[model samples]
Target: MAKVAIVMGSDSDMPIMKKAAEFLDQMGIDFEMTIISAHREPDIFFEWAKGAKDRGVKVIIAGAGKAAHLPGMCAALFPMPVIGIPMKTSDLGGVDSLYSIVQMPSGIPVATVAINGGLNAGILAAKILATSDEKLLEKLEAYSEEMKQSVVEKAEKLDKVGYKDYE
Candidate 1:
């Protein structure tokens, strides 16, 4: 059973949504990814949102552009954390989507990440799940240490090759 559900408004959002899938995969987290446009496929979207809890989805990563109603709607229907990844649109460069997802009603709140922030959404989901799962919590801690180590290694390498003589 998947712990996370990655939903997008269209397949065109795949390039952005895939980052969430990749992060979940790295953590050995099972996830289901699909397209369900709130505007074009309201019934299917509603069904997915309503059934997500029964389907074992602890967290939902919803990526959508334009009006970006998917995340907020999911928040309303699903009684779990919904992280919104607003894709960069050609018109407003995702400000419209960001605002739409972030400005949910007082009762319904969607955790909105930055525009095109799929990986952050995935990490946030893992962090939320880790609060209950000890194994996942350990994995998250190790992941954090690895990130710290990676940055230290990068800083060392940069010291070896200063910007003036970077080649």
Candidate 2:
């Protein structure tokens, strides 16, 4: 039973969506990933979204370009946190997808990330789950510390080498 479901409308989204999977994996979060187009195959998509909760999926990270309905649809049917990753499209550079996701109507809400922000979507889902799990929350804290340490190290190196000579 996966705690997270990472779905995308097209396989083309795999590159961006996989960042979410990788981050989830790093956080020791179990996740199931799949490609299901809401437009081309509404029946399958509907079934998957409707049954996700029953299948033990607590969070959904949906990536889609263009109209980007996958995340909103999951929000409508799953009754859980749905994070949307707006893919960069050739047409409008993903502004269309981003708007479609971020501008949800009253009740139904899909928490959206920046364009191609797969890693952030995964982190957000983990944080949402952490709210109920102390162990997970501790892990998230450690993760934050690691990130802070990384930046500190980089800043130290920049200070030592100076910005002009820093790698």
lDDT top scorer: 2
C-alpha lDDT (0 to 100) for residue 116 of candidate 1: 96
User: What lDDT is obtained when candidate 1 is compared to the true structure?
Assistant: 0.93
Q: Could you estimate the TM-score for every candidate?
A: 0.96, 0.98
Worst lDDT 10-window in candidate 1: 158-167
Give the runs in model 2 whose Cα sits over 4 Å from its true position.
none
Question: On residues 1-167, what C-alpha lDDT tens digit does candidate 1 reach at each position?
Answer: 98999999999999889998999999999999999989998999999899999999999999999989999999999998999999999999999999999999899989989999989999999999999899999999999999999999888888999977755
Give all candidates' CA lDDT scores: 0.93, 0.95
lDDT by residue for model 2 over 30-141, one digit each (tens)?
Answer: 9999999999999999999999999999999999999999889999999889999999999999999999999999999999999999999999999999999999999999
| Window of ten residues with lowest summed lDDT in model 2 | 71-80
Q: Which ranges in model 1 have alpha carbons more than 4 Å from their true place?
A: none
